[model samples]
Target: MARASTHPRSCGLKHRGFGRRFALLLMPLLVVGCAWGSSSETRTGDRAVPDPDASENVTFYPTYGYLEDDEWVVPVRYWVWEDRGLVSRVVTRVASSMAGLEPQQVETFRHRLRPFSGDSEWRQRVTFVFEDDPLGQEYQVLDERGRAPRTDRNGVVEGKVRIPAQRAEELLAAQGSQGGWLRWEAVSRDHSGTGQAILVPSEGTSVISDIDDTIRITEIPAGWSVAVRNTFFDEFREAPGMPELYQEWDGEGDVLFHYVSGTPWQMYESLSEFLFHEETGYPEGTMHFRTVRKNLVSISTWRDLRSLVSAGAETADRKYEVIAGMMEDFPDRTFRLVGDTGEGDPEIYRSLARRFPGQVEEIVIRDITDDRTLRPERLEGMTVIPAETIERATGPDAIVADLRWQPQSVRVLW
Candidate 1:
């Protein structure tokens, strides 16, 4: 494990307690222009555009949950498009800049926009039918009445579906020792969706990873300008060999991945797409995201950049809470906590180690900041690897060896 430097630099804006407090106090005033319709109009006329429907706009985000009693209580969510055309894009771009979106704030904006002053197809009820060979041999249609409220009024539907333990067990048996993901398909009246669910073995390693900075580059600790450039305008970049490293850890079977990040649920699609293209080899598991309230005010008009800088300050706490919950949920499973030095991952993981003890197998903190001083004292299972080291071909193997994780013989069935 990498050791923390004895002489660390000041921990940046996130470490300053006063900055966050002041931002909270000014939140109300700063968020006043968050409404979708409040932005200056760019169109020539007040003409209505055809709204997108389920067939063209619906998207499903893959997520997982622990098995409770006799079922796998998985969290399933899908987004229906109200509009994905130029008009909505223009509104979003203008609104985001006006709000001066912080990385976290940008996610909130992506996940929570509503029809401020437009013809809304937002909350139209839609029943989703789920089918999985392992869960059952038939399609199970979820009742519309039982579905939970949309995560966002701008067409995001949230709900949970359970797969029977018997079916899950059968699927595992079919995989024959090298447990693989159980595939599932979903469909609405006018759209279709798909995802995979992992039946975590009773005894194995589960890697809990942080997405931004840790794997995907967002330059979170960097101020609002860098955040905006990376998140909104720039292309998504992976942290060197992270994808291969994760794949190496995921070798064969006996390893599961759960991404717990401060990134809002709105970026689910974007992240999913990135993972798909990057071929990170991380299997779809449960993704825990920050709970961002809809900011009624615009993000662009803050009095100073300090307010925007502090927007995601609460993420450290949120990440801690989610990781703690994962520990409680899977008490028997060992974990490898992966994160970066940009935020409070080291402290958070240390606290988790103290709280859960032996359950944590290791802690791998990517040294994105490159300031070794920011690293904490060497703990029993913590290692800080510099980002530069990860860029090499040998980097992935070195990481695996350092973690002392034995690779299993994985069979690719698909």
Candidate 2:
């Protein structure tokens, strides 16, 4: 993924249209605002142990590493924040329900400002992002191998360490390929954190899958309110047979996974936990989530949230850029594109298939919309599997091109 703006307070979008549509929706909730400020930081602390008394905490983002020249470049990203408790007991009540209206283009916009999302889980999630003060803290890797990196204005630290390819291979080999964490010591706080790292080799089979309706059911087709309720209020429900199916592919031990989603980074912890849960059984792949910066303490934060609903924020471009970057980075590796018909996955994947032929081996689109008459041209070089019947596949892996599942002039009946 491309690096975000270097400036800390740089709110990326300044579109006027962002606020007009969602003005009434979040106006009442925006009536109440909070204040937050970061204190001067200090780096004096013991590196060996974590202190429960430490005021600041570090949250590591799970990511992947790549091989460049003779070294392995692994990204060490983290969020530094003070764990303030819930900001307020104020419930996020919907101003009005969107029962029949067509859902907006982006899921994040539709996922915002829910009325029934007053539960502790939803509140805590919001508080973590909006309430906490993200300090521009500094830290060094525990091994003292690379330069110590500091968190940006958003309290996020994006840095990398370069290890000799041979040594990196040794560590990865011992850590079980994707089963590894990098230890770090805080220079300013009396605490430490571990960042999960998945190492994708120079060339291999990688599965690029979508989240939302593709894996986790977000009910995008049910309209705006339901999608938001499902996101903020209800427990995430996994798509039928996907977790089991992904687990089967992950068991192969040679495949790499990349979960590309339009969901905001705020839902990362909850979504990641669900994916790694004992029942879910999905492979821990590199995550590609869109970032939407928000500060609940200000009325202006609503404008940032509104970007999710704005026309400019349609995720087709974001998904394309992310997936295309991956294909470019690993030119020799083959990729399998997986998504749902709930949105624009078919068209996006079709574009990728055309742009990078042979590199993308298969395109499997889960049919969330029950369109009996399929347009073969739209889904050219793809398999349209009904979302429900995808589980009936007692055979073939996710990328295994089955002749029976090939797309026809009408549709592929799985």
Candidate 3:
């Protein structure tokens, strides 16, 4: 009886050890299953949550173009945001950057991540009303329907509207000695929001001015840190006497001021605000901006990373393309190219002057860098004046004297 009991006890101990081993092996799988379940639930809940701060505020970005026979076409684009709040936007931007998703993927994810943020097709009908004189009389809003915003590769929707133009010569003649601007306002029928556009005279000397380092302090040649700080964190600071120089150049408001920059179009709102608040006396003609890549991190950083890598060669090429297009668009009007030495502006301007012989009147290079390599060489017919000489030149009288076309009498502000 004692031997039989011992055998049964031994078998029971063996069975207990096997059960412990099995439980140890199954424990990891159970933990993994629980983790996966929790994650799935969290994702589902996130998909169900609605965006509370979505708004219908619209933004406009106007481009310059001239129509045939004294008619002008101001091509304007608008953008509608799902959420304008800073924190929500930051979160969205981070998610967008990390995912590196395509436009369609982004649209799909918008519902899963932020259901109330709306899709890329969310477009509102808007109407533009011209308030100022001469312009109101000359041009009318031919098409009242605002375009449905289409998403670009970067998931940015650009809605377009062209403000029609007619009888521009008559409008210009009416202004006479008193120079003024034609203003128009755009308002959405569905949303309580508005945007403005200013039209300048297309005739006379067209001044193509560079924005970074030339007009605003962007320290491009200094280094990346300074450039990034100035662009994102620091306040807008204009170059000394640049506003005065621009005012003098626009004597009698005949000169058309077109701001051309290598800065991406994303910074348009901030730059426009800076221009408006600074009171630069610069007549808003047409704003030309660079094409941006479809990357949220690069966009959020204001393209500072790319800027550091670029050696100004690519920027010069872009500037040339934009300027050359302008020259082709307005063949009759003479151009005055204004830029700084931080980039290849001097070299680029010189090449442009050579390419368009009689069309390019002058090349004004602001010597931000004391580099002697950019010394002005006679570029046949066109005058290349340094900014230092411009400051001492004593207003329009002295400045015009340096130009090829010296009028008998010039407007003197100083």
Q: Which pairs of residues collide in candidate 3?
A: none
Please say which candidate is ahead in TM-score: 2 or 3: 2
lDDT of 2 by residue, 274-370 (tens): 7878767778777877655444444444544654554232356667777887888788889989997666787778778878997999998878665
The candidate 3 region of ten consecutive residues with least summed lDDT is 1-10
The RMSD (Cα, Å) of candidate 2 is 13.9
Error of 3 at 7 (Å): 89
On TM-score, the candidate that comes out on top is 2
Q: Where's the lowest-lDDT run of ten residues in candidate 1?
A: 396-405
What digit string (tens of lDDT, one per residue) describes model 3 on residues 1-414? 001111111221122223223222222322222222111111244343334433455455655546655446555555443332222233345434543434543343333323112222233444555443444532222334643444342334433334336443444345441343434454444333344444444566789989987878766654443354345434456777777777788675568778888776657766776664536545555677765432333343234334323443445566677787778777778998988766667667777777788888888877755443334353333343344321211221111111122122322110
TM-score for candidate 1, residues paired by index: 0.66
- Backbone clashes (count) for model 3: 0
Cα lDDT over the full model 2: 0.54
Alpha carbon RMSD to native, model 1 = 11.4
